[model samples]
Structures are given as structure tokens and as C-alpha cells.
Target chain A: MQKKSRGGIFVISAPSGAGKTTICKKILSRNANIKQSVSFTTRKPRKGEKNGEDYYFVAQKTFQQMISRNEFIEWAEVHGNFYGTSRKKFEGLVSSGFDVILDIDTQGARQIRNSFSEGVFIFILPPSIKVLRERLQDRKSNTKKDMQRRLKRAAVEIKDYNMYDYVIVNDILGDSVKKLEAIITARRMSSDRVDPKWIKDNFLR
Target chain B: MQKKSRGGIFVISAPSGAGKTTICKKILSRNANIKQSVSFTTRKPRKGEKNGEDYYFVAQKTFQQMISRNEFIEWAEVHGNFYGTSRKKFEGLVSSGFDVILDIDTQGARQIRNSFSEGVFIFILPPSIKVLRERLQDRKSNTKKDMQRRLKRAAVEIKDYNMYDYVIVNDILGDSVKKLEAIITARRMSSDRVDPKWIKDNFLR
Candidate 1:
């Protein structure tokens, strides 16, 4: 985080196979002013994944205690595991002048919108349903039944694109990354984000 | 202009001596998607100025006829010279798939806001009142009295920056230009500016 820099939330949501993780990683690598928010989860870490960096892996008992203590910005249970974001950690990062990207689902995105109205919400989309289906079908790890179910879920989730401030169609990787970078650059200069003292001393004084 | 491409209007304004002309010029040179809206004026062209390129230099009679025919998106008179933007020419450029930038004054900007509510309106400000006075004085052409009057008027004009969607303080030329470009790029991806058919076909289909 840079001194006196204005930080805002960038809430990004995408369907199961939208390549949002790749886009987000690319954005983080290209820009020094932003970082991805590490989430807290009760699920065990996968191979080669660092405990804190991959996720704040904790026991179910600790996760439930945090939930009861109202320490999460938003949390959800999926596939018998608890996943959540810490209210203290998010505010600490943002208020200390770091733009944090939250890659969550539609439900968690909605919850953040209610809590932080000023956060910039962006929705990543696949180029087309045909393309999305093809990509899913190519993943041999998934069975035919699982692929079809995921495709149907993606269709319904994409209907919420209109709710976002910017929608980037992930048709081309390079182009999508540029658009994401542009939005961040443009947002940083927004009048509300700029220091009033700087404006007063430089422009009005 | 490209076939079926989305188009939008960007209304830019600044007080006198705010470096708006330079900013607008840089934006046009850097962006291929945007074009300046050439205005119609009854004033005679100065030496080395091209008629169509600088403005649609029209006779007073033609200007009045346009006013009577209601052919202007917004028009105003200053120093006995009438200036106006052609409604037909402006819309022709915009609807034909070109994003147009209108460099106008606060009065004209207000008129555009009323007529085209969706247009992006941005206000430019100088670093300081002292700097603005120096820039105006350095021009060497204006009398001391004229320079003082202009500065006073500028202070009042800049107070209306709140009416704009974005306010950029031109303290540094390179940074300001980059911010302007980002705003344009981000705005193009905004949901409202995109084609409904494109979204429906690509995402929903």
C-alpha cells in the first residue's frame, strides 16, 4: 500500500469456467497498486498451495467462532465447507491504501454491495455460451453430467451482468486485461478518491 | 466509424486557461475511437486556419437559418460571434459508430446535459488560481484588465465542477492525459453503451 493512496474494493464475479482467476492474476502481475484479497476457508489446502497465500485455512470450529463473532464481511457454506472474508482484514487493507480484488460468487458479491456501496463491481463473461460449453467439454476431468450441470448454472449466473458497473467479455485475454487495467486507472483519478487537500493546495490555493 | 460499433458522446469543459485544448488534442491523437465535434461558427477564420477542420465557418445568414430550423444541439453567442454544433452532423457522427468529444463551455455543457442526458460530462481544472493567472498573463496578448477579468470569471466557472461526472485537475500534463484516456476506455465497456444484441447473443445464447 502507498501512503495516502485512496483504495476501493474491486468486487469481481464470474461463472465457474469464466477464466476470472487467470485474468485477475494477470492484472495483479501488471499493476503494483492492486492485490488479491486472501479468503478464509475451512477446506484443506490442495497440493503445492501455501496455507496463508492460497487461503487462510482454519478448522471448522474456528470458522464458526469467527462467524458467531461477526468478524466476516460476508461468508457462505458450500460443499460442506465454510468460506468467508474477514471484515477486519478487508478494512485494514483498504483503509491503509490498497486496492483489494474480491473474486467471489454472485451471492457473496451481493452481500458486499450492501455493505460497501462504493466498491467497483465488475463481472467477467465468457465470449459466448457456445465457447463456454466447448471449454467445459474439453476439461476431461469433468464427467458429461457434471459438464452439463455447470453449463446450465453458468447461463443463470450470467444474467446478473447488468448489475455490474463494467462487464468485460473474456473473448480475448489481452483485450480483457487491458479493459480491467483501464477501469482501475480511471477509477483512481475519480474526484471522490482524490485527496481534497491536494486539490485545495494545488488547484484552489 | 465502424459498422454496428457502439458510440457515445463525451462532453468536456473547462474554465479559460485550464489547458483543455491541449488535453483534448492529446486525447484525440492517442485514441482512434474518438473524434472531435467540429462546431459551426459565424466568425471569420484566422490566418492558416482550415474552414471545415477548424470549424464550419458559415455566414451569419446560414447560422440564423440553422437556429430557426432548430438544427443545433447547442449554440451560443460570444463577442458578437455565433457558434453552434449541428444536431444533424453531431448525431450523424455518433450514430454512425463514432465516439464524439465536445469541447465547449459551461453554458453549452449544460445545454448538452439537458438534451443528451447519457453523455459523459467531464470538467477540467487548473492546479491553482495563481497558476491560472500566470498562464493567462503569459499569453502576452491580453491586456492586464482583460486578464484579471478572465481570471475572476474562471474562478466562478470552476465552481460548477460539481455538475460534471468527473473532475480532473490538470496539475501534471502526462498524468491528466492518461486519466482522460482511461475514463474513455472504461466508459466504453459500461453496460449501457454496449449493444443489447451482442450481450444477448454472446452471453445468453
Candidate 2:
């Protein structure tokens, strides 16, 4: 028998303005084997966001109903907007042999890990606070107070870095993308995913 | 504080005449950060085998002395030839921030794993018996009995492939090398190797 392709759930977490979205975009565009998990959000789509493409947009009541139905793998609220990952979709993508990259928050990630403990968690960190401040400035808010508040929150969230399987420092974009790719590739070949019985039946026999 | 460099012990095992030596030579030549763990043997050096370079040729008396002193991390006898790897050399290379790769047999690999559970073990497999047969024909010994014996031993060794952290099918040389490189790169960023306090002290602060 030929070797079977194995897929894994990649849980990628990062603080705000940590350049995770850009890295994820580059990885998804280059490798057809990998795909980003399209999350469901109660908030309206932004100007350029597409429904089902960017997110599965739904009403707050609908999201609550799904949650009650236990449809979500994990869900959390951000700024009063509910966001979640659909369990059915996640399992479907993985079983189809696609590496599913979930760009989710730590809170949601914790919930996912409780249910899907096999997922590989990666944490992205900014090179320095100075660079983080500059990146945050490029966003909608540019005030010093806003930057400080965000930085403080980032420091708090950084404690969970230990929970990740890998950590990438976003100093250079190309290097960070390469690191992410390596982590995914390595995990795909991890012995935990390889069954000795299958090896014996196929190759050894 | 800057991110610290990490070094690990990579234990690589392969069956006889599986093209492991060539792949290992390529990896060593390309990656300067990776160093091979030279083994000491009681067998006399062949035409071009250099002392300490090819195999650390030693007398039987000296080998036994070292073994009795507990200087060797792992040792085994193959075809009446005593061979061993030094604990001192392995420790020195890793502590110096170099990834130490031990190209040893399954017997030696099992010993190392018992002593150093942190090491990453990788097993290389041939794509097919036809390819392996062709590769074996190119080697110095090509008698029918020898070939059968080697192939039988190879099948037995193939069962240990699951003991490795990763398995690379050596169908295409370039692709296998790339996969090995990715495994090493990803392992460098593994959370078990990264110091959490260092991250908190440097990045978070």
C-alpha cells in the first residue's frame, strides 16, 4: 500500500498587529495542501470582506442557536461580537487531507484544544515593542494611549506562549513564513501520526 | 535578551545499503550547523578511512577500557567489530549549540534513546525493494547469499521505522534532503527547546 497523506489542525495565535494574517496569507497562497479555516462571526462584513469567503456571517441569535446546538468547535466574544469555528467544517477539512490553519484567539484556542487536543498550536511574537508600536500605528488607532493599552494587553496574552507547540518571532516576513512552513511540514511527518501497524502491513510485509 | 540558539541530538537509523550514507553526507556538506557524531570502532581502517575522520580506529583493548569506564553513550558489536559513540563528544557538540546527528544502527539507537530521551530519531526508508536491490548491487559486496541476507536483515530493521520521530522515503534525493532540512528547522523552534522565561524577559518586557 502507498503511504497515506496525513492532515493536522494548525492553531495559530498571535497578539493584535503581530502580522499573523499576512504570514497566513503567504503560506495559503503558496501551498495548495494547506487552507485557512473560514470562521463564523456575528459582526457585519467589513468593506472588502466577502461572506463565506472571509467569514460565515450570521446574526447574534443564530450564533447563539448554533452554540446551543454544540455546532462550534470553539467560540468567544470580542468587543461584543461573537466569533467561532464550526466543528463540522474543521473535521471535514482535516479528514479531506487538508492542513487546516485556524487563526484564532487564545481563548478560543484553549476551548479547541480541550476538544481537539491533537491540533498543533503556534504562537507568533513581534520582534520588539518598538516595531509592534509602529505596526499598531498603521492600524485604525494611532494614539499613544491606544498603543500602550494594546501593548499591555499583548504582554498579558504573551504568557500563553508556553502552551504553543512552536513560536515564531516575526522579525522578517520571509523567514517567519519559512518557519511556519517547516513547523507544519515537520508535524505532518511526526511519529505520533505514523502507525507502526500500517508500516508493517504495507512496507515491511 | 535575544532569542537563544538551541541544539538537539538527532539520531538517524537506516537499513543496510539504503543510501543513508549519501544523504547524510549531503546534509553535512550543506548545513554547517549540523555535525555528525563520529563513532569509534575496533575494526582496522580500510584503504582510505582516516582516524577520527572516517571512524575513530582503536584497538580492542582501548575500546574495552572505554566501555568499562562508562565513556561511551552506546556501544554494540556487529560482525565481531566493536563500535561505540562517546557521551563526551555528543554532549560537547550540543552544548556548543550544534545539532548533533548520530548515524548509527538500530541497536545503538535504542541505547541512545534510553539514555537521552530528548533526542529526535529519524528513519530513512527505500521507495521499493527494486530500488533497494539496485542500490545494493552497486555496493562492493554483491553475492546472492550476501544480498539475501542483507535484504532479510533490512526487512527486520524496517520494523523499527516507527521508533523514529520522522520517516523519509528516499525515492528522490533532492526531495528527501529538503524534508530532512524542514524537520531540523521546525525542531529548532519546538516549544520544549524554547525557554519561556527568556521569551517573557526579552519579548514581553
Over the stretch B1-205, how does candidate 1's per-residue lDDT look in tens digits? 0125547789998878889989998998988878999999999897767888879999999999999999999998754788899988898889877889998878788899998977988888887778888889887768988886787678667767767877788889999898888888888778665566676676676
lDDT for model 1, on a 0 to 1 scale?
A: 0.82
lDDT score for residue B199 of model 2: 70
Best-fitting candidate, scored by DockQ? 2
Q: Relative to the unseen true structure, what is the Cα RMSD of model 1?
A: 3.0
lDDT of 2: 0.85
How big is the positional error of residue B35 in model 1, measured in Å on the Cα after superposition?
1.0
Model 2, A40-131: lDDT tens digits are 99998888899988899999999999999999999988757899999889888888889999999889989978888779999898887778
What is each candidate's DockQ, to 2 decimals?
0.60, 0.65
Which ten residues in a row are the worst by lDDT in model 1 chain A? A196-205
True contacts kept of each: 0.65, 0.62
Model 1 residue B99 distance off true place after TM-score fit, in angstroms: 0.7
lDDT of each: 0.82, 0.85
- List model 2 lDDT by residue over B83-169, tens digit each: 899889878888888988899888999998898877889888887777888888887747988888788888878888777888877
Q: Which candidate number would show the highest TM-score if scored against the true structure?
A: 2
